[model samples]
Target chain A: MSLLSLQSVTKTYGQGQAAFQALAGVDLAVEAGDFVAVMGPSGSGKSTVMNILGCLDTPSSGSYLFQDVHVENLDRNQRALLRRHYLGFVFQGFNLLARTSALENVELPLLYRGEPVAARHAAARAALEQVGLAGWETHNPAELSGGQQQRVAIARAIVTRPTVLLADEPTGNLDTRRSHEIMELLTRLNLELGITVLMVTHEPDMAAYARRVVHFVDGRVDSDQRNTPRETPA
Target chain B: MIWNTLLIALREIRRNLLRAFLTILGIVIGVLAVVTMVTLGNGATQAVSAQVASLGSNLLMVMPGQRLGPGRDSAGAPSFKLADAEAIRAQIPGLAGVAPMASSQVTVVAGGQNWSTTIQGSSRDWFHAGAWKLASGRLFNEGEERAGAAVCVVGERVRKELFGKQDPVGSQIRVKQFVCDVVGLLQAKGQSGMGRDQDDVVVMPLRTVQRRLTGSQDVAGLMISVRDGVSTSKVQQQLEGLLRERRHIADLEQDNFNVMDTRQIAETLSGTTQVLTALLGAVAAVSLLVGGIGIMNIMLVSVTERTREIGIRLAIGALEQEVLLQFLIEAVVLSSLGGLIGILLATGLSMVLADLMQVPYAFDPGINLLAFGFSAAIGVIFGYFPARRAARLDPIEALRHE
Candidate 1:
């Protein structure tokens, strides 16, 4: 069974003639240990798809089965539970809480799980170390380099040992070298940790690193293809 | 779960230290003012009540008419005299003691130091009637009062002014032009019910004051002290009848005097003070209400400012009740802390005022506790709406907020 699946999901905003469709009958599925990249142009509804997949938003009409449970029917609290227990998210903006150290930001997911501070701290340290950010736990997001902040974001996403890791333009704010470095880290985490990764990116070069590429246009998937050579050392 | 939320709240408050301080400041000042006002009011009431009680209960004072009667005003009005006091004492059945006194405010000189003081001359019974107590030496003797001797007893304030803690016993102080020997120092009487310092004076023999100070044979007022468990009104009636018979006043004519009872005066004064304090407290309470409103304003602002934070917590599986609880607690803490500070400051201020007014310093635990409870109540009352607003915020919309 797929770890995360969206079956004909659609999201609409407003009403009557003024109504807009942000996601239109989108269908996608991500299995365990799969690295899927969603590619799209501006206004192509890739962000809308990401929002739905992460459970940060709900579809107007659809059947979303997360671990065989229908996510589209889940209540707000249930969705929060799914997000806490199974899914993790990394944003392009390195959405670490301002004024918080990297270690504290990484500890956020554990806070949602109601873990004790000591246990949360230990898990956060382990996650940061996995991202090659050992000993940089005390540094704030603002103090770190672009790639380092992205690494911290990635660490926060996987701190809870979630089954799926979702990244929305993970390297959009980084330089080419830093972007490649972050992609390398994500690829390593997917391969070594066996965590499914579903990422959104506009760059073809970045998409090439994924085992599968799903192209979205006008709120629907235009094409889906498998990469010929997905394994490449950074 | 509670610990986490509290930790987060404390952290946020620390981060926004300036805002937190500003918010708490309103509560602090409000609580402080309320506590201080209540404490001072309690202290004042206690001091006045004590002084009134000390002057004796169910006691009546018969003062002379403002206008000279009988010989000057109406042909029927009788005059107040020392002889009237004697007649009242002899005729009244329920009477305990009766003492007539002549009083005047005059300059008292001891060596080069001269101080203005009220001088009262009375018999031996005057000590019990007016509640005067001697600190050193002895009270006036029948020998001194009968012989109209020149010996006198000075009050604490008068002794302090002239002698500067030195013993004034065996020393002589001049009352007007006549030198009177100070045989004793009176006890510190503190402030009287009417806000006057009861200790700033000297007491001499009634005959001596009549002879030397006024150069008149008549007394100014007659004080009748009623015995405990006796009906004061009955004694007053008997005294009035006797005075009329002694002075030969005709029927259908107004008596040339007013008999004032200390207990009645105390009740009237106490009621008046209570009304005044309540009015002052009501005014102060308005500020507390305003402080509660201030707390509400700050709390509302806090909800708005921390909307995103609320969203984050909600998204992470926090209950609406939890969010509401957090904000409400913050408000209560702020206001209650303000109340505590106000109470402390009021205690200090009340003591200082008591010293300045020459009254007994008093601290009432009940009033302090009431003020503190009032502050916390204000917090809860004002904090509700803001906390509700925070709890009702949509997590999705809040997350999207800037």
Candidate 2:
């Protein structure tokens, strides 16, 4: 069975006169430990696909299966549980809570999981260190550079040791050097921890870090290709 | 869960100290006004009741008029004489004591010091009927009272003004044209419920005030005390009937004199204070309601302001209730803290005002608890809609929100 699969899912926004279809009959499957990148134009529904996979949203029609369980039928709380236990998200904005320290930001997922403070602290510390931020644990987002803040966001995403990491435009706000550094971190996390990394990037160079790339056009997938990734940054 | 929510609430409050302080100030002023009004109201009521009670339990004042109050026009009615008091003492079966009371406002001079005070004239029975006790010395001797002698008992206020610290009991004071020796010092009873000074007086023999001061045989009023275990209302009815018969009032005509019950007077006076307190408390309640609306307004803006934060939390895995509880508890903690501060402030303010008004400082625990409970309820009521708005936001749309 596939790690996660979407079977001919269709999603529409609005109603009647102003209705707009964001996704039309999209079929996708992701294997465990695979790094797949989704690329599309601005209005091609790539982020919608990410939202559905992250369980922050559900498709308007058709089945979403995770490990042979139908995700479409899950209630809101159940979906939240799925997201909490199995998924992590990285947004373009690096949505770390303002004025919160890096370590505490990483500890947020564990806090929702109701873990003990000592364990959460230890795990958050390890996750921050894994993101190459061992001594920057106490720095708040405003105090950190954009690259460091994005790194903190990535650390926060992986702190729970999630099965799949969904990153949408993770390097969108960073310059080339910072973007390459974040992609390298993602590559290392995917290869070493065997986490399924599903990313959406507008930049071809950022997408080159993924082993597989899927391109979308006009709200539907137009191409899917596999390649040997550029493992080292220029 | 509660502890974590409380932590989040405290952090939010600390992060936005100025906004929180503004919200809290609204509640503080509201609660402070409410508590102070209630506390002081209760104190004034208690003071009134005490002052009325000090006039002697089950006491009645028979004023020589059909009408009562500020514009009491008693000129059309004949004043009561000492014979009326004697008649009431003889005819009323449940009587404890009676005094024929007459008074004249006079300037009393002692040594070089002079003070203007009321000189009340009545028999020795006036002590029991008017609830007067000797703080020092003694009441009139048989010769002094029976012969209408030139002797008097000076109340504490009159003594203070006329004789300073030296004992007035052995001193002489000039009333009108004649000098009278002070044979006793009456204990101080402070002020009456009507704001009249009870102790600012000199008590002389009835005939001395009638002959030497007023030059009349007429008494101003009758002071009567009912015996213990007797129903004062029943005695009042009997006293009324006896006076009607003595005054020769026709069966169809209204009686010339009016009977005033101390207990009834206490109820009326306290009722006035209670009404005033209710008015003030109502004003305060409106203020609290407005303060609650202010909280709602702030929370609404806060929910809007922190949409992105909420999006982040929801994305990470905060349940709807978690987000809801965070905001709700924040408002609760802020308002409740405001209530606590207001109660403390009200306590201090009420005490000071009570002292200034010369009323007892009465602390009511129920009111304090009720005020606290009300503020917390305000939190839950006003905090709900904004919290619900926060919880119901779409995570994707919220994330996209700038």
Candidate 3:
């Protein structure tokens, strides 16, 4: 069975004659350990797809199944619960809170899980170590380099051991070398942790890092293709 | 969970040190003013109550004036004669003792060291009515009042000023250059309602004071102590009626005499001071509201400034309630700190004022707790809007915030 499946999902903003459609009739499925990339032009609805999958936005009409449990109809609080237990997110800006230590940033997800301090710290440190940030645990976001900050963000995303890691233009703000480093880190996390990854990017080079690429042109998918090679140098 | 929220709040405050300090400063000043005003009010009330209680409970002062006249201004009006006191004592039922007192400020000389001092002439009951106690020797005999003897009793303050530590019971003090033997010394009574030194006077027979010092045959005021089981209100009514009948206030015109109870006056003054304190405290409480506005202002800024942080938290699965709790806790922490500092500042301010006013220090724990609770409430009242706004922010939009 697919780990995540969506059918006829639609998202609209505003109402009546002035309505704007961001997503329409979207259907997709992903199995465990799959590294998928979504590419699109501006306003192509790839970002909206990522938002829905990350549980940050709900489709106006949809059937979304995570581990075979329909979640599109769940309320906000239930969505929060689903996100905490099942998903992780990484953003382009490396949104690690300014002035917070890397370990604390990594421990953010478990904070909602109501875990004990010792358990939270243990999980956070292990996640940071997996991202090669063990020595910089006490460093704040401002003090770290962009690549390191994104690593911390990645560490935070995976600390709760979510089933899927959603990276939205995760390397959009980095240079070529730093971008490749981040992509390598994400690939390693997917391969080693057996966690699925769905990433949104416009760069063909970045999309080449994923096992599959789904391209969107407007509010709908234009092509979906399995990658011949999953390694790319940015 | 509360502890965790508190930790996050404290850290966030520390992250924005200057803003937090400025926000708390408003509450600090407000709460400090509140506590100081209340303490001063309480101290003044206490001082007046103590002074009033020292004059014996349920005592009345009957003076000659328009019956409906103001009591404070009635002091310098026409004086009551010794006959009037005798008349009231004989005619009135539920009668205790009415002591007619006559007073004049005169120069007193003892061993060539002269100073101006007050002299009072009174009958024997004046001792009980005025709550005066003799430190040495004894009170006068009733024969002295009738015969207008030259014998006298000097106060402790007068004795100390004239003879230092020496025994003043047998001393002779020259009043208006007339030698009068002091048969007793009055105990220290400190200051009185009129802010005069009560112990800086000599007491003589009513006739002696009337004839020798002032050359007037009338008394200054009458001290009437009501008998047990008789209320001052009833006595006041009876005295007013009798005085009106005797003084002949025919019709329509206010009777030219007044009777006042010391306890009643003290209570009225106490009540007035309490109201004034509360009014002033209310003014100070407005500042607490302003302080709450300050918290609100800062919280709004914090919510805006940390919008992306909120998004990250929401994205990581924080409930809206948790976000609200974090901001609310931050505001409460700031206000509570301000309250503590305000309490300390008030203590210092009240102590200094009490010493300057020569009043007793009044520090009540209940008032302190009340101030603290007020500050905390201000935090919650002012913090809720901003917190709710933050909690309702869409995570996607918040994440996109620059």
DockQ of predictions, in order shown: 0.33, 0.54, 0.60
Candidate 2's clash total is 0
Which residue segments of model 2 deviate by more than 4 Å?
A: A231-234, B1-29, B69-75, B146-148, B325-358
Supply the TM-score for candidate 2: 0.91
Ranking by TM-score: 2, 1, 3
Clashing pairs in model 2?
Answer: none
Question: In candidate 3, what are the lDDT values of residues A24-140, reduced to their tens digit?
Answer: 888999889999999999998999999988889888997888888888778878888888898999998888878888988898788778888999999999999988888898998
Ranking by lDDT: 2, 3, 1
TM-score of 3: 0.85
Q: Residue B133 lDDT in model 2? A: 87
Task: Write the number of the candidate with greater lDDT, choosing between 2 and 3.
Answer: 2
lDDT of 2 by residue, B1-402 (tens): 677666666776786788788778777777787788889889988998888788877888898888577766666788998888888888888888898989999999998899999999998888988788899989886677668889999999988887788788888999878989889999889998888998999999998889899899999988888888999999989988988888899999877889989888888898988898788878878877787777667766666557787788889887778777887787778888888898999999999999999899999898787777776677666666655765677677677666
Q: Better model by DockQ, 1 or 3?
A: 3
TM-score winner, 1 or 2 = 2
Write the number of the candidate with greater lDDT, choosing between 1 and 3: 3
